[model samples]
Target: MKTNANAIAFIMEGRRQRFRRWILVTGSLAALACMLCCAMLLLGNTIYPVQEVIRALMGEQVKGVSFAVNTIRLPRMLAGLFAGFAFGIAGNTFQTMLRNPLANPNVIGITAGSSAAAVFCIVILHTSNTVVSIASVIAGLATVLFIYVLSRGRSFSIGRLILVGIGIQAMLNAVISYLLLVGDQQDIPAALRWLSGSLNGSQMDDLPYLAITVLIFAPVILMLGKHLSILELGEQSATTLGVNADMTRIALIFSSVCMIALATATTGPIAFVAFLSGPIAKRLVGVGFSNALPAGLVGVNLVLAADLIGQFAFEVRYPVGIITGILGAPYLIYLLIRMNRKGSL
Candidate 1:
């Protein structure tokens, strides 16, 4: 009786600690994201005061402030926030589910697929944004399916999936380059901007679908978080515990791909937000806690923050993707070295 009571108390204590940790990490990330969002709105060419920014957001007719805040800043900020959250969640889901940090959409060709479709539309077809977005989503799903088919032998192999994805990404990149070379020089600048992932010229009209995609799919992924955790316990163990690993993986991949594709369509695949958010969230939240929300928040922070730095950190402005790519490259190198050392490559 005494031992049982002690065990019960210990379990309760663990639950409490986990709850507290979740609140702390998530709360901090949320706060940082809010701060960055506000900064994105307020810190432009002519800095708007807080009250004026609020009035603009509230639909007031304050001439200059309203025009700047509502017409320009608000849409840009929303694009970064929503796209960042989607990228973060999707990337984190892939990495956590696959049990490999390098399994992010950015590294594994999912974003490349979306990019290829959008670039083809822009450079070859001269299509509308809606058409480009649809193409991107379809291409992303098809790429995932292709990778899965190629990687499947008798059972799923993470190594084969990643290798095949990398190869596909390379091929897609080559296609993008060829399109750029043969395409009209007048359109090359636009194509380059899209590839570099700029939030410039964001319109309020373009946000609804991306917002809806994240809203519908993010919850599904979050709801499956427990199953994802179970799957982390190896295939046989998960099967013995009555978790259908294949079904769960398919659901996760489908949901995550939808969110990622929409985000790439919206912001042109802002680099490294997906690849970096999960590890940062895990470090902050520690083990044995759900890092999904925190990871999303981290992504939001990274995108908004990188955009601000790109805009004002240097004399010449750079796109958000360039800054993030610069940040992610070092981490990628470090990861490769670490993996090589461990003979996990």
Candidate 2:
């Protein structure tokens, strides 16, 4: 009896520690994201020195700085912060649940779906940003559903999901190429720009849609985090413990898809923050944290760092996505190597 009691007490204490770690890590990431956002706003062309920017935040009388901070930079910074966080959290959710670090929305063609749709809209359909964004959301959700159905032949398999995803991605890339080839010469620049995955010209209009979507769906993602942790222990064990495996998987996938779709709609599929952040977060927190929150934090950090680097790293500015792809693709290789070396893959 005493031994059983001790075991229970130890487990309870461990759970407490885990919860504390989650809260601390999440809070710290949130703070860092905020700071990066402020820097993004204040360190641009026509930067309003830090003092005046702060005064503007506190509603003091700063003239040109207030206009620059509140009018111009604030919107872009807010867009990047929220969109980065959404992609990170959503990516982590998919990776942990599938128990595959490569199963992020960006990896498995959801972002590509958005990219394809946006490219088609920009090049072929000749639509504005609003139409392109809506199309991207619809296409993103549709892509996930299509992949899920195609992968459901014998039994649902990760291998199938991944294969279909890769196939679809290749096909989408071809279509993008074709569109650019045959597109109007004038429109080609616009389409090519979107394909490079930029966060430039992110106006206030882009924020409300994503902001509301993230705000509304964020609670659902948080609640699903507990299910994700259990689901990580194999589907059979999860089902044995009263978890509805199919329903749970569908719901989590849906939540993640929406987050990715919304973010891609705003920021043009900012590459592998989704693919890389969760595994990195796992390394940081060791085996204890499978909650998806930490992965999202790491995701936001990765994107922000990449964006800042892209913005001010050299004479010429690149889109945020290009920089992240360059950095994240290599990090992904390293992660796979380490995982393989340790027999963790």
Candidate 3:
């Protein structure tokens, strides 16, 4: 009885520690994200004071501050914030569900599908932003469905799914290249810019859909966070734990794909935010809890910070995607090497 009591006490103590660590890390990430958001609004070409920024945000026209804050910086900051959160959370969901760090939308062709659709809209159809976004979302859903179908031949296999996704992504990327090659010179620039994943020229009118999608879907992901953790423990174990594995995975995948698709439409597939956010969040939060929120928060920081760095970090201004790509590529190489060493790749 005493030994059993001691074991229970030890388990409870471990839970308490994990919970505390999660809270501390998540709180820190949230606080940092907020700071980055503020920095995005404040430290643009003209460094407006916080008071002026506040007044500008509050609808008071403060001369030079109002137009810059309300028009340019506000929209840009919002795009980075919401889109970052969407990419972060959705990316984390995919990684967790697939139980592989490489199983992100970026790797598995979901973004490529959206990017291809959006590029087609820009290059071939010469469509409006609304058309591009809608097309991207539809294409993203279709791409995931196609990938799932191709990989689900007999049973669900992670290796098969990833391989199929990589193939699809390569094919879609080729399509994008062909579209770019044949596109009109004037339109090609626009398509190229979008493909690089920038926050420039972000408009207030274009934000509502992406924002609303994130707002509605993020909670669903969070609610299923526990199921996500269980689903990571293989199908049979998940079933044993009372988790409806298929239902949970379907829900998670659908929710994640939607948010990520919308984000891609809004920001043109911001490189590796999805791939990097999950592992970083999981590392920070440790075990025994869902890292979805932390992952999203980390994403927010990455987008906002990367945007800031692109704008001010160098002599020539770069797009957000370029910075993130530079940041993520090295990590990808490192992850591959480590996985290869462990014979897990």
lDDT top scorer: 3
Stretches of candidate 3 off by over 4 Å are none
Candidate 3 per-residue C-alpha lDDT over 1-345 given as tens digits, one digit per residue, 9 for 90 to 100: 999999999999999999999999999999999999899889977898899999999999899999998899989999999999999999999998889999999999999999999999988898888898899989999999999999998888888999999999999999999999999889988788888999999999989999999999999999999999998888999999999998988888888888988899888999999999999998899999999999999999999999999999999999999999999999999999999999987
Return the clash pairs for model 3, or none: none
lDDT of 2: 0.80
- In candidate 2, the residue pairs with backbone N, CA or C atoms under 3 Å apart (3 or more residues apart, or in different chains) clash, namely none
Candidate 1 lDDT tens digits, 274-328: 9999999988988776788888999999999999999999999999999999999
The C-alpha RMSD of each candidate to the native structure, in angstroms, is 1.1, 2.3, 0.9
Compared with the true structure, model 1 gives a TM-score of: 0.97
Compared with the true structure, model 3 gives a TM-score of 0.98
Global lDDT scores for all candidate models: 0.91, 0.80, 0.93
What TM-score do all the candidates reach, one by one? 0.97, 0.92, 0.98
Name the lDDT value of residue 62 in candidate 3: 99
* Residues 43-159, model 2: lDDT tens digits: 887766787888987877687887777766777677777787788889888888878877778768888888888888888888877788789889988999999899889888886
